[model samples]
Target chain A: MDRQRFDYLLEAYGADFARWPDGEREAAAAFAAAHAAELTEVLQAARALDAALGTRRVEAPTPDLLSARILAAHKRQRGAGLDWRAAAALAACAVFGVALGYGGGLLAPVADDGDYFASAFETPFADYDGDEG
Target chain B: MIDPDADLVRSAGAGDAQAASALVRRHLPRMVALGRRMLNDAAEAEDVAQEVFLRVWREAPRWKPGAAKFETWMHRVALNLCYDRLRRRREKSDPDAGLYVADGAASAGDAWLARQRVAKVGAALAQLPERQRSAIELVHFQELTNIAAAETLEISVEALESLLARGRRALKAALADVAQDLIGDADGVPRV
Candidate 1:
């Protein structure tokens, strides 16, 4: 690896060679062996960083309350308002909507309001006038 | 290679109680750690971890393993939860601002000094922009591989590295005095 690429990896992954990307590990090691002086500087900086940052121990104990709460939430979801029957009913409605959208025209075309009006009006003014007379 | 959690996830999805419990136990600590670092509150972190597992339990049956590692997905969920809480905090103008600072009043000796450094680091971390803090948290603290961390943040590996570099620089700048105290002697040499 070149100096620039090696520096980038050093900044990104710190001095721990194992943390470097697997593909670049061999090249990185080779470069480190060749450039011991620069590697030493980087390692020193990374070690200081590790020391400073690692001081605070972050512990995440599995509290019984948290575990119980999580399990209870899961169980509640499983048994809650949206059971299989409700899911099936929702699915059936969706299927009905899709079927209507695709095949409704084949069963019956919607009549035109203008055509119905025109046919009724054309039924003869004469008949209407005679009846009025 | 198949992820070790693939089978557990499948069983969990199939409503297997033991498998679900195993998955929770396996992933909760890291998820909580991630949330704590991101949110800076242990109680809230625990809540976020619970929500993440709740989501896992609901979505497990439909989990497609080959697309990504289950742990990566879990990290994503926890990150999302943390982000949500952060947004809410911002909306409220940080009513709980003091929650981020750990109690450091009662310590003595090296323990006190070490705590000061940790508190400074944590404070500096909290001061960074959200994405940079997340990048540092995922890589430095969560110990996710760069590729996995990138996937968790939904960014490229290159972008993730860029964020890390910037975050590290900012951290070094913010913790300059603390770093000096911890490692720098009067002559810039390390203390024995």
Candidate 2:
């Protein structure tokens, strides 16, 4: 990295090499070390700004209530999805049951009430006569 | 690119409470931090974080990881929410919109000074243009890789660097005094 490029990156990313672009970090570090005597002033300025920016601390303490609320929302959505799926499954089962009953009825032999009564009468008197004998 | 959060996101998407909770635990703080930096309001920051997660849950089941990582997408959503809120603040033109309110409880000398310094730095950050502020926040505070941060902003890495440079320059100028104080404090000089 040339002086111009190094200074540009330094100003942009501050003194922390970790913050520098991945492709240029090693080259920039080498340049800095090689010209430490000359780059001290610029590097110090960048570090100073970094430290100043660091003072603006943000404490991100996640409130339990917020977490619970988010999780609850997720559960609620999932629950609704499950409810829909369950309803669909029940409907499908009902439809299948109806179809099976209809299909079985169609496939079964039809019984004649007339034939049943005739056969019953045909056997009724014979059994009675035999008992009497 | 292999996303580290892919497994978690998939499990969470499939209604795994443990996975969802883990996702929340891992990303909630960073989301909150980004919002806090952008909006400079704790309550609103929490709102942004919650909103981001809400979107996450909504999209999780259908979330197809494509170009961006899940974390990067979350950051983009959070940033857009922040930008929307910022735009609304501008439309309403609230005088106290970006003001950094120091804690009234910090009465101790050192604590008060530190709070003052924080307030100053925050105000300076607040003054930056939205893109510039976002660039600095992502690179400096969020510590996102350049590629990730650039994707979050929907900008090229070169443009991201430009924004960072401009943002840092403005901040450097604005926070010069605070920088001096910090440097002084670091050098063993007593903070007055």
Candidate 3:
């Protein structure tokens, strides 16, 4: 890599070779080896920033409580999801039961052919009783 | 992509409790670190990390691989959470309020000096425009690959490089006085 590309790589990845893009790293490293003096100055400047950036250390979450909380939350969410699925399955079963019952009734021999039309009209009790008398 | 966590992620998505725990344990530290660096508040960072894990739990079952690496997705979620807090901070900005306190107890010695330097660098970083600061944090501090960081930021690699260049230049300028302290030699060579 030329100085321009090398500088760009330095800016993009700081002074860390491992952080640099894979393909150009060899070229960049070779250039650094070739132009040791110039590269050292640039590398130093980048490293200073990297060093300063490194100083801010964030404490990891306390192992016991944090992990427990995370897993508990996971379980709670999964449980809720399961609950919904269970409810859905129950509803589906209910619908299927009603459908199956209806279909079975339809498939069975007709108790009365007039049964279908029987519910279509409502007759006063007096008319039925008078006709029977 | 060959995600190291792909197996754990798949197991977690299948509702394996142990797998879920493993995934949480695996990714939580980096998420917390990213949150802390982006937000500069330990408690808030923890909250962000928790929120990220919570999302993971909810989405894991529906998680479809080949879309993106799980850790990359986690970073995106964590960054988004940080951005939300940051926006809230801006809205509630108070001139009287200090953005950051001294990092720790100050005492005479190199330790205190080191803390001071870190604080100075932090303050400079905080002063940068949010995008520039984020670019620097993701690539430099978080050690995300340029491509991954760009994906996290929803920007092109070239744009990310531009931001890095600008961010680093700004950082150097901001810490110009401390440059000598950073590297002892005027030629920018480290004494070590």
Which candidate should be chosen as best, given DockQ against the real structure? 2
> lDDT per model, in order?
0.76, 0.87, 0.77
* Per-residue lDDT of candidate 1, residues B8-111 (tens digit): 98987776778878887888778877777677677888889888988898888789988889888888888888888988884223322223324456456655
Q: Which docking class does model 2 fall in?
A: acceptable
Interface RMSD of each: 3.0, 2.5, 3.4
What tens-digit string does per-residue lDDT give for candidate 2 at B68-120?
89989999999999999999874222322333445557668877687678777
Cα error, residue B70 of model 1, in Å, equals: 1.4
The candidate scoring highest on lDDT is 2
Native contact recovery (fnat) for each candidate is 0.37, 0.71, 0.52
Off by over 4 Å in 3: A59-63, A88-133, B91-108, B185-192
Writing each residue's lDDT as its tens digit, candidate 2 over A1-133 gives 9999998898789999999988999999899999999999998899999999887656646789989999998899889889999999999999999999999999999879998788879876777756554
Shift of residue B19 alpha carbon in model 1, Å? 0.3
For the second chain, the TM-scores of the candidates in order are 0.84, 0.90, 0.84
> Which 10-residue window of candidate 1 chain A scores lowest in summed lDDT?
A51-60
Superposing all C-alpha atoms, what RMSD in Å does each candidate have to the true structure? 13.0, 6.4, 8.5
Instruction: Give me the runs in candidate 2 sitting further than 4 Å from their true place.
Output: A96-133, B90-107
TM-score of each model, in listed order: 0.74, 0.84, 0.77
Residue B133 displacement in candidate 1 (angstroms): 1.3
